[model samples]
Target: MEALDTPVLDNHLHLDPRYGRGIDAVDDFRRLGGTHLLVVNKPSWHLDVEASEGGDFRAVFEETITTVEEASEALPGRAWPVLGVHPGLVSRLVDERDFSPAEARDLMQAGLDVAAEYVRAGDALALKSGRPHYDVPDAVWEASNDVMRHAFSLGAELDCAVQLHTEASDDLTAVAAWAEDAGMPRKKVVKHYAGGRLAGPTPSVMSEKDRLETAVERGEPFLMETDFVDDADRPGAVLGPKTVPRRVRWMLDEGWEDAVETAHVETPKDVYGIDTRATLSR
Candidate 1:
């Protein structure tokens, strides 16, 4: 992981401003000469995880969005934001928990309203890019489409990209359908953790890499990202941010660039689907 501090894109980053305002983390990244730090929103369960700290679930999304806006003001152009939605659509997850759609809509609307402030400034819409995980229902798949369609409409209106998360599952297909349904601009979608699969050895699933290549060949705006993290004391650390790029870099160097635009981008603009003109400027 020595190369980690080398200023990678650090896609799928969760910054709990509630944790050090990420000043130390940014310093650590910059110390390694890192270029960008895309601060993706974190799941409600992820806040203060190592310390059992979490903000109000209802406010987590809005708070994070506002935080990204502030980071943009602070960094001017370095803190790229990512609007990735993981944990299988917050509404679907909480619905099973007895939260009504009306309640969820309130949270979503509030979050989106706050999100719009930054999004209008040009943030990429980061989606989980996954199928159903952890017993997520099929309805969640439709739920994902609903989220993507709505997000795609907003992203397109804002001239941003819809960063969808997908694996071997048909998640990408769902997104494509959503885009078509919304008549959103289609490009190579950003594929996070290109070959990284957290599901653990499911031979039946399609690898993230293959799907990305497909997206690229199809003339989609499929970008590859290194969503690596350093979790020392965990064997999975080997697979986190360190290794994701090694393989990605190899293929990228070996003619993959023609297939799609690959970059180590981190900033509110890049994360939420903006053109990221500055972040990708090599």
Candidate 2:
């Protein structure tokens, strides 16, 4: 198949050479016309690192930045890092590590602080944090929201985006409220794995045909992502690395060229404040 004139961007993806295809996965995306990636850091435990303090997360963030750099080498400035403490880690801290809920929340907030430092230092483009996507105790739930609030505040201070990984919900008014309280703009907060237009933060719609069509028909600003975990054990768990480009190809084939530019170029640029054209050219 011929590549489209416009570039495709995958807003959320993970690349781990130790457990997955790593650079080869990135090459897969590239080969399929995906020119840009927002490479999110996996949970700390995924890297076999258990963090007690903020500094302990440095290794996790650094490894993610390294992956971004490596992906960029193959695709230039098209790849960027989004680092943060996964909300699920709170459960691990409390359950396995035997830390109290408050302590776990504080540690996750500190880790987000570290992620902000990376964004401040120009190593990453955004910060990521969200509440658990599953059932949990009330205390754990509250602590997770607290951690997410800290991330919103960090995003406010750094003037960068914050990608959320939360339960599937069409309504995000609570998230919007927190972002407002933290002085972060609603548009700057992205809802990863979104289905369609949300009431709160901008949706980063996953690459599913129905959702993509819905997002386009709505004519509201939204980003597109594959959420590719890149795990060999669960190959194409969420979606393959090539999904975004392939979907973009569908958009173009279906005569949704304007939607392509809006989703892959304009929306991401507005949220992350990056020059997509220049990055794609590089």
Candidate 3:
């Protein structure tokens, strides 16, 4: 793989325990010129069973933080955590865990509280919370939005960034409006796994050049991501972990270096305050 002259940062990925790919994944990214990555903990398929059985969600949060810490120690400043209660988990709680609406709200609030604490302590970078896997029931969708609003409010209070995982075609205008209503800046919101059609003022992360060109043409700040699921069963589920570096190298080769620089370096710093230069040097 050809490395870019400048380093890149992947704003969203899953390096969870169940996935089984650990430091080796990190090393592969680094070798491809990936300077930093944000490890987002999306509640796995099995979390519903555990949470329903009275398993503490805090342990999951702690485990994610620990994994990120270990990765950072192994590859200094290269791994960071973005903790939150995935919105899909809310429906799972209701259907699988037999949680009432009130109970689900309570658990979601508690999870956000823990995530906020870590952000305040500088142990995490951002909160990754939003609707996942479209086609949810209307009630579940509304409830998830309510949870997301609460998360945005907490993020505002804590001055932490938020990464939203929603349908690629969903209107971000509403999302940006919600963020503004929650007293959070639109710039602090990132639309995870984004594509060409943008809906609002918030930034987005995408991988393909054509879509990236569309985002750049709109003059909106954006980042890049692989959204790597790390599932052996779903090889390159979204894109491989090293996809960003290779795409960035392609962009640089195609005379989009300035755009790539802004997306990979400046936009991440603006959104998450990650100083890649300083971080990599350390």
Candidate 4:
């Protein structure tokens, strides 16, 4: 396939050197014409950080920043970091660690504060937060929403985007409301692992033919992502790192050059305030 002129940015991705391909996975994407990506921090357990306090999350955030730095060195100015507590940590704290719902919520909110510090220090570009995608008790659900809103507050204060991992739903109106309530723009609340039917919040749709086509046809600005878990145990679980660039090539082949520019260049810039063209030029 011919290399696309537009930049290919995977809005959500992971790299785990201890358990997965790590830089090699990133190299795969780069070799396939992926010029930019956001190396989002995985769950705390992925890095073996058993955090009972906010500062313990530092280990996870630092590891992610290191990965982004390595990726940028390989593909200059092409990789940025998004740091925050994974919403699942709430359940992990409550069930696995024996914390109460309120305690778990407080710890997670504090963890997000630590993530916000990274953004403040210019070490990260965005914060990741969302409620669980599975069934949970109402108390856990409420606590998770509180945690998500705390992230929004941090994003508002830091002037950065918040990438969310939430349940796939046709109506995300309440999520939008949460962002608005926290003084963050709804567009800055990126719905990671999203589909085309989301009614509110910016969608970071995975790289699938039907989903990409659907998002494009909807005439709403959205971002593209691979959601590569980068776990050796789950190789290519969600999608591969090469997916976005390959999808870009397909979009160009199918005469969706404008969509390529929109997803890769325009939407990312609008949401995260990062310019892929500028990154490429660097």
- For all candidates in order, the CA lDDT equals 0.44, 0.90, 0.76, 0.89
Q: Residues 1-282, candidate 4, lDDT per residue (tens digit)?
A: 455577889999998887889999888888888889899998998788999999999999999899888888777447999999999998899998999999999999999999999899998999999999999999999999989999989989988999998987868988889888889999898999999657879899989999999988987898999899999999996999889888888888898888888898899989999989987853
lDDT of 3 by residue, 1-282 (tens): 554457578888877556557667778787787777888875745433256322366677777788888777665457889988877787778887788766776777677777888888988888878775668677777778877888899888988788887877646888888888888888888888887456663556568777777766766678888888776677666778778888777777778767887887788888888887777744
Error of 3 at 15 (Å): 0.6
Number of clashing pairs per prediction, in order: 32, 0, 0, 0
lDDT tens digits by residue: candidate 2, 10-82: 8998999889899998888888888889999999999999998999999999999998899988873479999
Question: How many angstroms is residue 4 displaced in model 1 relative to the true structure, after the best TM-score fit?
Answer: 13
TM-score of 4: 0.98
Per-candidate TM-score against the hidden true structure: 0.59, 0.97, 0.90, 0.98
Tell me the tens digit of each residue's lDDT in model 1 across 1-282.
233322234445555556433444444444443445566666544553211112233255565666656644433236655553453444454565554444443344334444444556554344333334455545555554455455556655666555555544433444555565565544424444443221211111122456545544554223344343322333232233333345445446567654324343323233344444454334
Candidate 2 vs. true structure, TM-score: 0.97
Sequence-dependent TM-score of model 3: 0.90
**How are the candidates ranked when ordered by lDDT, highest leading?**
2, 4, 3, 1
Candidate 3 regions with alpha-carbon error over 4 angstroms = 1-3, 44-49, 52-55, 74-77
Q: How many backbone clashes does candidate 3 have?
A: 0
The per-residue C-alpha lDDT of model 1 at residue 103 equals 45
